[model samples]
Target: MEATLKNLWSTVELVAVAAHSDVVEQWDGQTLTRAFHWAQYCQHLFHRFHDNPTIRRVMEKQLQLVNESVSVVFPEHTAVSFSDLSRCQHLLLVGLLHNTKLPVSLLRILFDTSSPVNKEQAGYRNVTGLCSSMIECKSACKVLSPLVEVSDVGADAEVQGVLLMERLEALLSQSREPFLDSVLQGCEGAAEHFCLVIAAALLTRKTAAAQTTLEDFLLDWLLHKHSLLQHMCYTLPASLLTDLAKRHVKFREAYCNVLKKWASDMEYSISDGEWFQASTNPTVSFQKLTEHFRSLSEASPSLWEHVENQLNALKVSDGDFDVRGLSVWGDLLSEIHK
Candidate 1:
């Protein structure tokens, strides 16, 4: 298994390069068949071990790397390659539909069936473009098109919000346990990513239903408050929500409310024991704490200050603030002082 894993990753790297390189469309028929076969086999392994962190991480990383490399041109490349666009499209489709199992509804939304789109056209066009491309020429588009209901999607914000939320729930439920496993791993990375994903999904519509959905989701996040603070105590996440709030005031307040609780918990968790601790490692090193904060602060200039000012006023006004818990699990304050 280990040797196969090694060669498998090597093959993945080579396949990614081919999927992205200008040379792809020119590959001999034999080479093309082998590449597709390998990718398909890998997809099978991915599904078989969907619950295995080791397998999921490797597969997700490879697909991410492939997409990034294919979509972006390196500085070294004298010119960009769009010729392999079809091949890249094919692999990406198989990866998402077969490998990732991304919800079909959203994919359809990203690609409008009334008019088909290619990747280049989609990127330049925004969601308008993204919703237009189909796939892999394996006729996944045919399998997928019936799922879209694009013709039914209209300018109904409430309905759009409803549809979007349904898709979001599908996405969330797909790997809920796996995602929670990562969340419980002592880092805010997964929860922070989840927040961003939700924010993007919710903000696209302008409807009362959309507003209610956002409110509900934010409230639900209280369950993951500790996870939120792991990334929130710094800047980007806070700043991001602040910016998002300009369009909806509740977003700002609801987000700050969670931070306030995290701060309150931090004030007590050091001596209170483990009721609130989320990490499997109950202990946290100051170095990891500082490093995490530093990365968040650097994500945006002065973002830390803006978020801190708002949250500090909310959590520290009682004069009970403490830094000790921040170094430990479930808390988010102490790392700043040291």
Candidate 2:
């Protein structure tokens, strides 16, 4: 172990085991808060190690050490505030994100469902909010871009796209209306990132959990948001369309509606939308869709249910669904049901 990682490993191990009870009482508030942020930054270093295979291997060792240290020290409901545990987990997530070989679907679950201190939504939103200004996004994406094409229907790379989309969806679902709405506006670019992040997630073996997460991302998005359905039907080809259609009933109806719209208006397709056009390269297009999909999937079930109820109240049916991609999805869905 290089002295640097060795030092970090030792420090993390010591800090990791210092149970919540140990910190809660002595909490300096500001100091611990700062430490939390510092830890997250360090974890980001591990995230980037994927590009440097040697560093990644070293990071794998250090990561296990750090994770074990934290797990032993924290151990769920061990008198830690949701805030603190979330901070720790969020730090871990940064590390996980940079660990490019991790499965994107697995990472998505870890981000979406793994609420260490009940702040997964805030934790990710805050990171994403800073992603544009932070150089980390560009750096991380460069490393991960090859692993995930962000385009190419049913490609393994899309799995990473799904995970990111799911994590963001969970976050959006939990956010307040105004805040959620604001995120929707900013989410386009953030989604494009994580080709590496998704790739990392995919690198992890495909377990049932991983596959379920993939399913969850697909079902969650299709069932909840029309925007994503709009994106997929227009941009993705038959394979993805078929996967989604086989999974849900409402999506089938919605897909049909989108196809009908495309037939009606050649000038306006989902591809023509600002979000879709952010990058014309298929890779870029796929990244945009992935990001949008993540944002849509990230919505919390409670909040998502509320959105659904509201849409229902407005009687928003397939007739009103004008996204151009819908018909491809419909074609796929129709085949699945058959």
Overall lDDT per candidate, in order of appearance:
0.44, 0.42
The residue-by-residue lDDT of candidate 2 on 256-282, one tens digit each, is 455444423322245554223323223
Please estimate how well model 2 matches the true structure, expressed as its whole-model Cα lDDT: 0.42
| lDDT tens readout by residue for model 1, 1-338 | 66655545555555545534544434443444455555555544543556666865665565555446544553232221111221333443333333233344434544556655443321222232242442333255345556654421222322333444564455334433333233334233544444444454445544676456644564455335654544443333434454554444455455545444443343234465433524423333344444544444444456557655654564455454454443233234444534
If scored against the real structure, what TM-score would every candidate get? 0.32, 0.29
* TM-score winner: 1
True lDDT of residue 53, candidate 2:
63
RMSD of each: 15.7, 19.0
Model 2 TM-score (2 dp): 0.29
Which runs in model 1 stand beyond 4 Å of their true positions? 1-11, 19-25, 28-44, 52-174, 177-196, 200-258, 261-338
Model 2 lDDT at residue 64: 68
